[model samples]
Structures are given as C-alpha cells and as structure tokens.
Target: MCGGPSAVVQVVHVTSLRINNYGYLERMVPASPSTWMATFTRVVAQAAAGFRRSRRLFHPWGECFAGTITLLVPGTLGIREEYPCLVRLSKGLGFVGAVPDALGLAIRIERPQPWDVLMVSSAGTGVLGRLIITPSALWTRPCYSTLMPYQRADGELMWLHARALGGHTVSVRRNALTEAIKGAPLGFELLSGASNGAVHWVGELTLERTAEPGLSFDPGVNQVEYLRLYPGWLTAIRSSAYLGSRQSRGATLSD
Candidate 1:
C-alpha cells in the first residue's frame, strides 16, 4: 500500500542526500565478471540483432503522444516547473491471449537537456512491490516504477512512480492502447519516494495522441547532473544493451 509524503521528515536538496528515516547510502561493490556476464551479454546481443532486423530492441511498436508534466510538490530531487514532453506507451513483449505483458511509459521531458524517464509496470508501491515486475493486461491498472534507483548527488537513492488516476481505464491487447487513449485521454498522478518506502504526490502527467513521431529515449545519456542512475555496474550493463540495440538497427542516438 502507498502512503502520503512525510511532513516531519525534511527531504532537502537531492544533492544533499539526507532523508529523515532512510538509512545512509552504502557503496555496492562490483563482482568480478564471470560466465554469467558473458552468457547474458551474448544472449542480449543476439536478441538485439533480431529485434533490429525485425523492428526494435525494446518497445517495438508504441504510440507516441504530446503531453506535459507539472511538478506540484518537488521532493528530494527538487525537479520543479512544468515541462512539455513526449510520451510513449508500449507493451514489453507483445504477449498474446490472457498473458500479461509488462507495460512501459517512456517520457521525454523537452528541456534544453531532455530527461528521459522510463517507467515499467510494478507489482505495487511498497518496498518489495517496487522490485517485483508486475505485468498487467490493462494500460491504466498497474503502477509504473523507475525500477532502478536514481542516485542523488549526495549519495541517496530515490524512485519515481506513476499510477492512473480519475478512472482512466483501458484493456491492452494487440491493438488497444492507441484506440483507448484516442477516445479518452490518459492521466496519472506522479509520486516520488525514498527507494520504495512511502511515495508522496509530486506532480501529474497527462497524455494525448495528437500526432505521432519516431523518437528514442536513453536514461543513461540524456540525464541531468542533479539526478543520476545508481549502482554504476548495473547502469553500465543497461547502457551496453541499449547501445547494441541502437547500433544493429543502424540508428544513432535520438532526441
């Protein structure tokens, strides 16, 4: 279950990395590369090649929309001001029948240096819930989490989440998401928290599919200095995978 933001706990600048009840940040020592890493790399490379040949590496066929994000209550990261953004919604694997497919919400904040926020559907908003990947058949049902923690300049880890609000509903099948959003606009209440503890209302995201555009979002590259991905090794692997996917497709880094 999700709770409101704490009033007493003073979450200052994200760079300061100080939360009232949260524990101190600890360094994650990297393990020596083993067969595990090699095998994973090989498999990912092969998969990226196949995806590149067919369509894309990650969310292959997605519907893009023009939207805006309003930061109502900037928390630790202190991301203030509203932003004009482009939002993309897609199913991870294109699972058929009753199988639940992981839903993705990719947002490109159109600032001088754009911020790409890629959120995946999560099991819940609690500690354990944020870690577990919860695939959903409905586009508006599940809560999308950043998955990997965003490290603060002061060494604190934070997370961003979005859950559909105001009863905007849609069942995601092969070709359903686009039509649903066309009839009724999709809206989500943005939430931020320490790791996955308790999330507070930070802002709102509203999306509309007026016109479509081909674009790619990279969380590793297009990042602001204030907010960075934590656990260097993990982000390194993610960046490699994204690179392979992009290269095989004969596509350069897109804004």
Candidate 2:
C-alpha cells in the first residue's frame, strides 16, 4: 500500500550479480557487432547460473530486497511514464517478480516490524515507509481493513502513524482520526499506555469538524531553545558535554 496524493508512487526491483574480470583478452576479442551480441549472451548465461547457485545456498528474500531498493530509488522506475532504462536494468539484473506497475517516483520505507517491510504510498506518490509484518501477524490480524491518517494543523493530510514510536507523540487532526475509523470497518481503540516513561492518552477526545487550525504541541524542550527549529541538530553538542563530564570524572579518579 502507498500513500500521499496518489500521484507519487513508483516501485522497481533489481537482482544482484557478480562477474569475473577477463580484462584484456575479452576486450581484444570483442570489436564487432556479432562479438558484442555473443558477449551479452554469455553474460546472461553466467548471471542465470549464479542466481541459481545463490538461490540454492542463501535464498535471500529477493522480493524484500527489491522492495527495499524500490523505497531507496523510487524514481528509478517511471511511475509517470515508461522508463525503458529501468526496464532494461531489471531484465539484465534477473528480477523474478511482477513487473513494477508504477513509474519510479519518490517512495519512503516504513518500518513496521523488525523483519518485515510493508510498502505504502499515496495513489501517485512513490512508496512510503516499509511496514514489515510477520506471516503469523498477517494470519491473525486484519490487513488494510483500517488505516490511520494524520492531518496537519491546517486540516491538510500529513503523516500516518501506522505504528507507534517509543518516545514520540503524534499530533493529528481530531476529525481525521474519526474519519479513519468511519472509512475503515476495523474496530478502533485509542492507545493508552506509557511511552518513554510518560503517560499517554489520558482522556477521551471529542472529534470535531471545522476549518479552525489545530494547535501543535512540542513534547521535548531541551535547554537549547535557540536551536528549536533544527530538531536533533544539537545532539552533537549534548554528546560532547556528556563525554567531557565523564572525562573530568575519570581524571579526578586517576588523581
């Protein structure tokens, strides 16, 4: 599944291969069109042989790997138009899955579970974060029956929190939350638990529909307020201070 304005999703997959260098001799023997065609045939044969051997030995999840690569390089496929270059690349690389339906566009890799990657994207936007789910989870839980959509203060669709991060509180439009429930048949329940030692979801929320802008809340307030605009920018400064303090203590112990 993908998200966004339905205009940015694209996915592509390529296989990995290895080749031996037969440098001077091979180069000197391949100057004509027929020779080049023969060289291409040989390369394909070798790649196929390698793929067979590797599949038997490691059996690396090619689908997962291709999906990961698609997230990293969405525009590599022509989600908007035909991308012959990507098509050729996939063929040459020996991909063994369905041809990418969309042109390569911007995609994000959503991390849902430890070992699984779920692909989500808006209609046209490339894939979003990879949401990985275990096979057992798939069997036990309903998939895509319900989705959570987050909205910005201006009532615009923002990020969707498919899974909760340990220390992050997602701020979303109240109406959007209700809409998500109504749009999907899955039963909805508010999250109530401790995250990062802080109590979350302490009260019932009433959903309202209006044009008014929502309030944005900042959960973390470090002393360096001047650098608030740049989130995580002062991490290095904090780390340095912490290390220096430890060093001073170590010197004192030595003395």
Candidate 3:
C-alpha cells in the first residue's frame, strides 16, 4: 500500500500505532541515532499542517503523470526492458505555495517485479532546466538527481541522472505545478558511471497521467535487484529520515 495507489495490494502492513495529530513532535521517537530526525519531523509537520499517514514531509507536493520507459541494465547485471510507467512529480517539502523546494520524481512500473525510481532535482543544462531547487518558475524540463549512490553488480558505486523530456512550452502556475505536465507527454532516462569514465545508459522511463489512482511509492520497499542502494553514512541517515517521517505520521515501515 505504500509504493503507489497501484501498490496497495502489495502493502505488507506491520503492527500499527496511534498518534496524536497535533502532537507529532512531542510523541515522535528518534528513528535513528541522528538528532536531525526530530527537527526534520517537526519542520515537516509544520509544513504539512499536521501529522497524518496520508502525506509525506519532504516531497509532499505531488502530481501524477504517465509515460513509456526503457531500462538499460548493464549486461553484467542481467536486466533490461521497456514498460509503461506512472510518474509523480512534487516539491520535496510541504510548503503550500509555488516557493522554491527540492523537486522530486517517482516512477513506478507494474511488471512482475514492480520497479520504482525516486529522483530529486539536480543542477545542469539541457532541455532540462536548473538542477537546484529555487524560487523560480516550475517547469517540466527540470533534471532530477537519483540523490543516492547506486551499487553496480560489480560492486562499483555510481550515481544516477534523470532529465524530463517534455512540457517545455508550459507556463508555471500557482499552488500547483500540474500546468507543467498537463496535456504533455513526459519521459526520462537512468544512466550510470561518470563523464570522466565509461558511462552506461541503464534505464529509461516514460510517464502519463490517468483517471485511476496511481500506486504509492515507497523507496524503502520498491526496489530492483540490479539498482541497489549505496552503503555509507548518507544512506543510513536517509533511512533514518524515512523512519522518522513514518514515526511522526504514526505509520509502519514497509517490509
């Protein structure tokens, strides 16, 4: 139930807890060793206007879109395919306005081993706009950072990149970035390696919006075998952040 609206059937619910909607800060237990989780959860609760399992702290701004995507895995990793996908775009914060916030993208593929990708805005130039999150106009042409180190099959640590391929002519709107996506088809790619080295095209994704509710995306659970999480302090902190967010909202972490 956590990976997307379409993921509802696969949600593995654990024991639950009840929390006071307005007392998130007071009742939230530390999800990790870092003290940042407490402050982060408090800040997010304020932005979201309350504590509830229905929303996220960072990346709370959400819009559903659809497209076709291709996944180009390294031959050594043994994965490659093309599929129809659902995409969600949002600001990585609970701010209620068109103000600057980290932009995020989540793609969910409904295949045998449902794959999910979550990306955050990054700095660069192309048909894709700015990589940093600032109080500029929201455009579909933005590039998002995979924001984590990916472990290749050979145990190499790599980063990922995804740039939007549509909605360049649309204007920014207030309270919603949907205008950046309406009536426009969207697509993106996932690449590994670095410019200084042998870069590899690993995955491609296209997305569309629909009347049907999309599946909820939980990066903690929805993952592919080839694209593995990096091992390090940052990843640990990120896991803590997710745990902190879930605790504040009175939700269980997915298996």
Candidate 4:
C-alpha cells in the first residue's frame, strides 16, 4: 500500500479463460489469455455498469479509501471450473466486466490520486468550475516469447505471444510443453502476479497525489479557505460500492 499513514491495496487477474468460438484447441492459446480476456472483460463490465464510483474514495479529497483490488480472467483457470465465480465477484465488488475472448486483455485499478495540477489550477482561477477529476494509472505492458510454427492435425499454425509484466510471464508455444510442465497451476500464478503489479501502481499514484496541492490550496491562497473548501469539493467526488457480481469478483486469495 502507498499513502499517508494508511492505504489499502487491491489486486485482480483472470483465473480461467476460454475462447468458445474455436472448434479445436490450439497449443498457444492459453498462455496469454488474460490479455485478451482483459480487453473483453472491460467491455462486458462497462455494459454491466461496473467501476461506477471508483475515483473519489481513494485520494486526498475523499476519506482516503484503500485496500481493495480486483482481477478478471477466464473461467478455465479456476480450480473448480466454476463459471459463476466471475459474475459473482464482479457484481459483488462493483468491479464487473470480466469477459473471455481471443484478441487482447486489460487490467485496471481504481485509487484516489490528486487532480492534475493544471485542472486544479484552472479551477482556482475560475476558468474551470466544479469538475470531477479521476487521477488513476493503468499499465498494459506486454511480454513476448518465441514459438516454433507448427501445424496441428488440421494444418494450422498455433502460435501466440507470451508476454508478462509485474512479476509473471506467460510462456506460449505451439506444443504441449506448457500443459506438460506447469498446466493450470502455473497459469494461475502468472495471472496473480500481473494483477499485483496493476494494484501496486495505483497505490503509488495515490501517495503521490497527497504531496501535491490543488490550485485552490496553493501556497498563495488563504490557508483557512483552502482547507475549508477541500473537503466540500471532495464531497462531489462521488462514492460507489465495490461489490462482486455475475461477471467479476474480488481478487483476494485465501491460503
């Protein structure tokens, strides 16, 4: 966690993913499903109205909300092959939108950070009035790995890019090496690691926001009015409950 004295960390990722449209299975498909999964999930979550009120709770303006992270992945990665887990998690935590697909993936974290100095500065000078600013960071670093182009019995190249960030890497190949050595276990670990990195970056940004003052709170402004107005403006930041739903879930793991 990164903040002044108190902060909460949340992590999320995909556990199991599957591409339903593909008739036959390919070797390189599983290694980096989360990337594709992330992309699909966001679209689904938005349609479901997830992540509605994430910005206001975690910055210097609000009550300093912390300690929550959420991840989205495919259902094939779960220990129980449970389909409802994703939806249950998303709706319950307000994270919603964990979809599975074949293109690319994404992971997003919501934490309170300071409004951009320029935004606040403009507000102070009356150029911009009553704005809701969401200062959060997103990381979508991709990883790459080599694979031998091989034809399946159907004569098609099963190749995928194995990229990783944070502390995990997915090794995709056009062979059985992935399933033979690690199988489902290692895939779960990799997803978790990526989620951790996403959450860590959010925490870092929240802490950075506290050190910077808004335009109204700048040194030249009256300290008393600046302090008095800060909380009121924060009230406009809005608040939403982080709950689990049918398409998403909280990323907290139990030992």
- The alpha-carbon lDDT assigned to residue 155 of candidate 3 equals 75
- lDDT score, residue 68, model 3? 74
What would the per-residue lDDT of candidate 2 be over residues 1-255, giving only the tens digit for each residue?
265455755432111212346422222332343333334444544444454633211111111011121111222343321111000000112223432221111111222211111112122111232122211111112111101222223333322212212232211222322343344321211221111222222111111221122111111221112112122434333333333332322222111
Candidate 4's residue-wise lDDT over 92-155, tens digit each? 1222222211111111122132211111101111112112121111111222111112122333
> lDDT (0-100) at residue 163 of candidate 3?
60
Worst 10 residues of 1 by lDDT: 14-23
Backbone clash count, each prediction separately: 0, 34, 26, 52
lDDT of candidate 4 at residue 37, scale 0 to 100: 43
RMSD of 4: 27.3
Most TM-score-accurate candidate = 1
Model 2 segments beyond 4 Å from truth?
A: 1-49, 52-133, 136-255
Candidate 2, run of 10 with poorest lDDT: 83-92
All candidates: TM-score? 0.74, 0.15, 0.65, 0.14
For residues 1-255, write the lDDT of model 1, one tens digit per residue.
Answer: 158775676544322322122433322334334323433343454555554534464566566888789875334466668889898888787566546788899888887998889999998778888878888988889999988988877788888899998876577765576787778777899987685497878888988664465667778777878789877778766766665555445556563
TM-score head-to-head 2 vs 4, winner: 2
